[model samples]
Target: MPQSIHFISIGGSAMHNLALALHQQGYTVTGSDETIYEPSRTRLEKQNLLPAQTGWFPEKIHTGLDAVIAGMHARKDNPELIKALELGLPIYSYPEFIYQLSRQKQRVVIAGSHGKTTIVAMILHVLKHYNREFDFWVGDPIEEFDTTVRLSSTAPLIIIEGDEYASSPIDSRPKFLAFQPHIALISGIAWDHINLYPTWDEYVDQFESLAEAMPKAGILIFDESDDMLDVIGQKERDDITKIPYLAHPSEIVKGETFLITKQGKRVSTKLFGQHNMKNIAGAITVCDRIGITEDMFYEAIPTFTGVSKRLEKIAESTDRTVFRDFAHSPAKVEATTEAVKQQYPDKKLLAVVELQSIDNTNKSFLDKYKETTDAADQVAIFIHPGSADSGEQITTSDIQKAFQKPSLHVFTDSAALQNYLLQERDASHIFLFMSSETFGGLDLSNLAPKLI
Candidate 1:
């Protein structure tokens, strides 16, 4: 019989995907979570992998269980976690298990403060077009793929969006540290997760460590557009092959974007923006290293719509449009807002961002937003005053002053902000909602239609 494996907190995107992957691998999988959200809850139920109910139970821990996978959401003192510790069963963090499975496969680890998901999705999309059999684990759900995570015993390659966040409670190392890929790509370095790495230098140190972990003969791909990455990538690393890429050659003709290839052929893409162009270049470099030719990369890119929530268009009318993006970091916020502004240069841009993540909630990180929202014709910064329950010391006024943009508005309440948008938004405007987390209780989708 296959071994029995249980997950302590299996409701998360990564956790749920891992649980499903294990089940597909012939393991008898059971999992418990305090709560499960849509898509995950539905997907789990479809596979008969949903827990009997929500909340952890110590009784679920047993000697018959061969392994336990604990999610980062679960604390070290969680009842299931404590029981698993007492039982002395083999426990693996989600990334640890991914590393174990990909040990024999040629792994490509994509790391960055932003754009990792898009780059990985681009690579996966091109590979799929070529009918190349490879497994991947991305952070967001790709429309073309059924699941965010996939694993196969016979697949020769594995692609992973290697995040720098801590793996689990017991394991404080960044999630990417476990992979130690044969070929690695660092998109760029930007200070983020102030709660984790309190200082910018400390945050950069993680990427340095990732660089050092590369095998002697492995390759390191980096973005030359980022001076910080340029400095780090150019440093004397004797063993690794370093390849640098800037924004791919492209042109905007009659408001349409097209790639200018080495052969002088112009190929158009469904996606837009300079950031996405850079993302495409990074993915193309990886594909070239993996034996895919330049022609194939360009040929496959036209069909790539993009990963969900990176820059998803929610609703559109004849004269107005609403876009929702998962952009919370200072760098991401700047890129996302700038992308929208550039796309609809003539349209009045109103960018609304929720300071939901731990870093954005911290007072020290507020200054990073300085001029980040300058591209927007009007900017609204929303913060759930109660988001930082730990009392790390931050105020909406501090964020307002930090941005230094005259048009910036700060909101502690979502209702007032919603009302402001409804009343102020006009037919010739583009509304962009940016956040890594959901707006306090507002559904951007439901609100999109009313805007029109």
Candidate 2:
């Protein structure tokens, strides 16, 4: 009989992808969730992995199953979890399961507070260009990639975007810890996940722990541009190979970004911004260690567009273009705004950012935003119309005090945000929206056409 696996609360972003990957591997996959959101819902249904019904059924757990995989969406008292526990069936969190499957392969993990996803996507993109067979588990959905998680028995390497966030409610370990890569890359280090990690030291400790976990022969790659990563890259790992990368030289001409190869060749690419130059350089270093040369990197990197929600173009016309990025952290917000402004220096740049995650939304962390979004000509912050201002959610006054910009605009309601965006639709301005959450759940595609 085929190996059977069951997932508890399987409709999450990562959970759904893992389910699809397992199904593709010929495992008998079954899953249940109380609430299944878009994209995940549609993707799961197409794979025939969607549960027969929406809610979890304890009866779905059986003694004959091979193992049970649980996601962060599943609570400790989830009926399926309780059933699995009662039956004494083996249970593993998503990260644990990923590790178990790729234990035999040369695991290459991209770990950082930011840019890890892009680095992972770029590595996968370049590896594909060279026809290198490797598997991956990225947090966000990268453009052109069907799923975030890919697994294969024949592949000799597994590239993972190993974030420092908790693996699951039951597992307090960081998801990256479970992977324990033989080769790892730290893109950049910053304080984030304020809710989970209360202090900057705690945040640093996670990445430091990741560094210390490497084997004697393990290779560690990090960006030397970041101050914190500079410390990480030079740590006393005498036996481990530590590679440091800076931004790959690039120039924007006639609104197109080009990578200046080592041989002085100007290679045009879809990617822009100084930060992205660093991302490309980091990816190239990773590829080089794995046998891909600098020439191979330039060839493959040109075709790389970017990952989803990271400077992803939503709507464009002859006059105007709108970009959406998943930039909730303070460091990312600053870099993303600077990048967009650098791309369209002569045009009027409007940047609207939202506070979604605990770190970005928490009032105590407001001081970190001081002058973070100053790069944009016009800066704005969107607070959900119906959200209460108490607790972790911040108010308009809170935002105004945080950034301390004289001309910054704060839209407390979706209507005002939408109306403002629509009013600027015809203006000669470049719009960049940075938020982990949608702008008051507004459909940006509908608004993009009316704007420049």
Candidate 3:
């Protein structure tokens, strides 16, 4: 008999993907969410896993369920959670369950404040390129992978994008703490998730704890360019193997990015930017530890166009191109904006950002974004209109002063922001829309109808 699994909040991106993965693995999956959004709703309905009704029902949480996968979206006092507890059903946070599922496999955890998703995608791409059988759980959707999370009894290794965020509302430990990886990589550390970890030192300590979680004789690989990571990587650990990597040697030729191998061989890639190169270097080091050759890596990596929304080209013409990225944090915003500017030095780059998270409007957080967007020829900031009443008073003057770009544009209305983008659009410009949300319900499909 297939195991019965109930999900408390299946509408979340990761939660829905995990539910789908378990269903594909032959489990009887059932879930409830207060609300379900597009893509996740459609995907769940397609699998016949969507609940007949929205919202929770304690009656559904019976003793018949083998386990309950709790998502962060549910409150601590959720009735379903209380029912599951009273019924004595095993309840596992998404990360806790993932750790249990892949406990037997050689876990490779890619962790850092930034670039973890991209690094995981690159590793998965190279492994798929070689036709290697493996399981993975990444935060974003990959090109060829049907789902963001996958598990199979046959696969011997599991590659996980180790987020440092809290596992669940009830569970305060960072998600990576549960992985206990056999091989671990930390890209870099910059303070983020201020709502959870209020101070930078507290956030950095999470990475430190993750580093300590590694089993003796485990392999630790890290980015040497980051001072904090360098200090962490260099710390003496007699039982572990340490490998440090820097950005792969590369040069731009005629507007195309290429990797310069130590053997003097040049390999071209569809993905550009220094941050991406650094991600590839970390992936290659992991591949090397697992017995993949340089020839295989170079041959396979060129075909990797990168995962969706990591500088994804939404629309393009002879002169102008529109891109979308999930870069809400200060470091990511800078890296993504710089990448576009460096790639098309001759073209004008317009960077549009949406401050959806409350942290984005925090006065102290604003200081981190001071000069991050300076690379763009012009910059625009949009605050979600619905959030205007939330009392996070971030004004146009606040944005202009924070960015220190006197000419910066700011908007609180979605329609006004869309019109502004259209007005600023030109044949010689590359439009980059960067946000973790959909720019507060601004439909990109209908954006710039003339340009597309």
Show model 2 residue runs off by greater than 4 Å: 386-393, 425-428
TM-score of 1: 0.95
Q: Rank order by TM-score, top first?
A: 3, 2, 1
Tens-digit lDDT track of model 1 for 173-239 = 8899888799999999988877788888989989988888888999999999899898888888878
* Alpha-carbon runs more than 4 Å astray in model 3: 386-392
lDDT of 3 by residue, 142-202 (tens): 8788899989988999999988888886787889887889999999888868887889889
Q: After superposition, how far is residue 70 of candidate 3 from its true place, in Å?
A: 0.8
Which model, 1 or 2, shows the larger lDDT?
Answer: 1
Which residue pairs clash within candidate 3?
none
Task: Using lDDT, give the best candidate's number.
Answer: 1
* Model 3 Cα shift for residue 109 (angstroms): 0.9
lDDT of 3 at 317: 78
